[model samples]
Target: MVGTAARVTVAACIAFYLCRYGLDAAVMALYATFTVVALGVLARIPGSGRQRAVTTLWVLPAGTALVVLGTLLAVRTWAAVLGMLVIGFLVAYAGSAGPRIAGAAPGMQLLYILPCFPPYAPGTLDQRVYGFVLGAVLLAAAQVLILPEPVTPPFRALLADAAEAAAALADHHDGPAPERTLARARTAADRLRPSRVPPADLPASPTRAHKAMAHAAETVRTLLAQLAALHGAAAPRGGYHAETVGLLDGIAAALRQAARALRAGRRPGAEPSVAALQAGLDPVRTRRAVAALERLGVDDRLVFLRRRALVVQAADSAVVLVLATRLLLGDRGVGADRAGHAFAYARTPAWVLWWRRLSTHFTPRSVIFQNACRFALGLAAARAVAGVLDLSHGFWVLLATLTLTRTTSLETRWVVRQALIGTLIGAAAAGVLLALVEERTTVYALVLPVVMLAAFTLGPLRGPAWAQGGFTLVVATLFAQVAPVTWQLAPTRFADVLTGSVIGLACGLLAWPRGAGSELRRSMAGVCTAVADAVGRTASRVVEPSAGPADGAGIVALNRALVLAEESLAQYQSEPREETARQPDWPAVLAAGAHARRGERLLPGRPGRIGDGPVGGWLRREAGRTAEGYRALAERLRTGGPDGPRGAPTDPDAPQLLNIHGLLEVVPPPPPDTDTDRAAAAALLVDAVVWLDTLTADLRRIHGEMAEMARRAEPPGPRLA
Candidate 1:
């Protein structure tokens, strides 16, 4: 990281010289880059589509660097803020759109890429805007040509892990060692880092690459799903061919790309590549997904042995409500989003909430309202300074302080607290460094490398709050170099930052109005939906003991829902609102989610040890066979060609996993819990329709609450009127 930072310093300087600004400009720009990269890395915490967007939003780093650099160098503020907003919007646009459009795995890129640049740049507001536009373009180009490559790296490691997982299932079923095989596979997968060593040596054709990646995904998914099924036994008979599934599905997506490429008459290598890897299998991350038809446990399935075909047909009723009511509403930003907002609001705190709310309310004059209500106040203040004011940098700095400075997680809050401390320390260090060099050439050289070190150390190191503070200080001191802050201007420059920060807070509050209650309601709804979806998926799909995929898919979805729920709980805790919360049995909602998680194997809970006798052996054999079937399927998928991957001609020894309906069902009373273990196992049983029913109830309840509020606010419903 230090070496990288050193490289960053040099590059920043070159950009500075080429871009022509102050030394402080260079340092601040680098700071933004470091922040963006760090945040992108951190956004991996877990939450909503917007949380993913926030994580992926890259403009913060790039734009911030530009604005700060410009501010110290005498660039106008307006340009800085404008650049920040435009790029911020673009960043948001890209981050949000990417996941909805790109294949699931690649969405991880948002975490890796968004934070590599400044969210706001420094300078004359116009120049800052220009800087931002340039930086955004650079980032876009980098992502198009470079970003996808990194996203694919994690999966390659994942691919290898899947292979090992398959091998583990194989050996376990074959009565050899299971733990050792699984351990090795786990370790191998852990090492795949998209940050440094991405996946290697592939064909030039993106379609081919996509195909390889897709195949890799299928192999991993199927194998992991199967491995999860196998308890521990060595089965002799063959099972579903897994390698074939992974390979074929992977190739299918690649072939789709290939077809497009071939029709376009482009050379394989020369084809205009949208992705570094060909897009692969449709991610069956949904609750009760069809993809898990192979990975359900028979016993687990039997528990939910009644219901089949869980369909979630949500017809966007909110649209009708939106059109009908004069006051339109949609649950676009759920409560999870509200907490996610807190993470972004670290720079300015609850102002994050305000901005989100204000943006929605001022839709008719959204842009104009934002500019006038948010900026005009700040602009008026800027004009007070001089007609030659720099509003752009000020604007974005304010914006980031509003949107990006979040405290959603303890870690996130800690990150900011550390950064602030770092900034203070940095101010002092910079003062010391400034005193020593007296604004000389040697000072410039010395500070440049120091800034680089800060960037690098801040990348991966974690501990006490001091880490961020110290890191921030190091960069701040070096970037707040004295070359620009001559004897006469030093105090004023320092004061400007404080002023900018204050203005930023003020703008954030006024511009984008937000309320906690709405977020809470929305988030609760989402969590319920996610919970129901996960439970439903598990019950419906994970019926076959041998193929048990629904469990894993359910695990992933349930975990996501859990995260949103946890976040909601935290946000609800963070700001206590009397009216918006409680009454709705949060504990029950949480308990339901908890139940979903345990049943899905996403959380830690013992499934009870069999009496260590005949039952144990029988269970072991069953699990082993399950493992074998999963392995067989995985192997078949990885190695199989065009003929539908599995179910091919000439395989006799394979243990068939076809009869699934008998294995699982949704019964009225989940198998009688004779003992504690039985009860816990029963608790793990999925209830697809049950969760959905609960969700519908909750949604209706929330709607009623909203309706009540409306009734109270207006004259009344028909009853009162």
Candidate 2:
């Protein structure tokens, strides 16, 4: 619907333009009108209002301050200086935030507004000269009145995340049991998504929700992992593992089904399999869970079901707020149809998603600091060019300025190279577009969507850089030819854009940066260290599930490790050096990681790290038979396989375990204090010492690079709220 609406709207708009104005004129008007509409939409977003107000308040003064400072510093006044400041502010802001932040969304919207501003505009009256400002305010008010409460994708996403988290937690405590843990986990995840209308649209309690949700998630993960082990072991179908996996297959079903059931205002005749699935991990969680079930006034099953329903409601509401914000702000006004198609494609692209997920490991703050210095250099370039150049049609340069993609010098230099190629092609294409501009303004209208499509097709699928060159041409051509002859304007515009990109790009390359390899290597060490810690900790008496810092897999902690491993592999693969330094191949890493995770998950009880004291020792014993699990993981990470069996360690007695606890602490007296006793103690101590030393050595070797990166990089930019 979004895609169709966008395309049709453009077609209708253009058709209207053609009749109301000459072809050349209508196309310009269309671009102008769309640009205004898009900016109006962006101004409605939450933080953007603050950012805009701040920027509006700051830029003029900042510009003045800089001008004075530079003059005092003996710097020359330059026309391009203002443009450089604009780009700098943008990079700083966008780079500071996560996807949820208002940074990039607003930055992208700048493209729409730029073409309407003085430097780029063709002496046409600023649209705001009319009642456009008042009209926009009125439109905003109407939309707020009409738009339904936000609940949509963000809410669904939140619900899903909460559910997944709960499932993870259940795994850690109760673990999977046919009747209890899975169903309980599902209920926990589902509770946030409600069907009933909320009261007063009250401010949400996000932090509280996050904590509860995190706990539940940990439980669900622990159980599901155990469940997966059972399946891989080819254990029987009706066992806890089978049913647990069934629950995982459609986590949302419990809430989705329950919502319908609730809205129907009648008890469901037979709940979907999800209710059963939600309880899959309960048997091991300590009898407290089961006891809690009995204590509730509702039937045991219904109690769990109702709990999940609440989760669903909360999750749904959060998502609504997020998506509502996006709809209002993510406008660059290329064309509503084109923008819609781009967003649809961008949001759902399978490959892009894989990449985005990979990028999530390195926080946005890190990315900004990583790129800022280089981008600043690019800004300098655009500034110099803007001041010096005089091309008849120069916006292409500005467009070209925005075209380049940046990554570690190793990752995909091709992205940068391709952008350059696209720009060259687009420049050639722009000549044709310009010629047509004289005869038909509709030609520029044709140019706008085609440029967007071309940029989409030729470059990275999303982001500002992709279609910049083409769109630059659209703006440059329409204004230059249609508004009357202008030779100097184009050159200045092109140079201004070019210099900004150059400055930005160079700063990113330098600025005390660290390579991702170093980061990944450190994560590798940390992953090993964590495993060792988990193993060693378990050596002590088993911490009761109900008592202590909780039991089972510190599954969330482990997930973080896995996420790091996954992230490392991506960085490794994405950033292969020009020659030396063996890049860790991601697919290989993923395969190895799978086996390693299986080994950890398989341990009946929570495992501890190697040499993690007595508790770790117990954890090691439970993690897998022998020290083989750790040894196997270490080997596979370096050179080998996902070649291990599941369920091989079931019901093992003492020595059959690797006995990390035994290594860490004195076992019951070995015998009388004769030669035998002395020899035994000495030998054990020596062995323990050797193992500890080796483990630490291995850890440092694996993660040395990552540590170095943290030391070198700038303080991470302010995190987007």
RMSD (Cα, Å) for all candidates, in order, is 20.1, 16.8
The candidate that achieves the highest lDDT relative to the unseen native structure: 2
Best by TM-score: 2
lDDT (Cα, tens digit) per residue for candidate 2, span 269-327: 44322324324322212222222223333432233322322222222222222222232
Off by over 4 Å in 1: 14-87, 97-154, 171-178, 182-404, 409-447, 450-485, 503-527, 530-721
**Per-model C-alpha lDDT, please?**
0.35, 0.36
Q: Give the TM-score of candidate 1.
A: 0.39
- Backbone clash count, each prediction separately: 136, 127
- State the lDDT of candidate 1 residue by residue for 1-721, as single tens digits: 3433443344344444434344344433443343333332322322232333333344446445534443443333354334334433333323212222222212222222222133333234444444344333333333333212223333333443444344344333233345666666455434432222232322111222332343233224433333433323232357323432343333323323433432343334422221222121112112222223223454333323222211110001111111111111112222122112211112222443334333332332222222234433443343333224533223223322332232222223433445444445545655666566665655565566556555445645643233433444443443444235433232333344445445444554554333222243344444555555544443333232332442244544544444444444443455433234223444455545554543343211223222323333332333344334323332432343311212221324434432334333322233232444434333223232233333334333433433343344445347663
lDDT of 2: 0.36
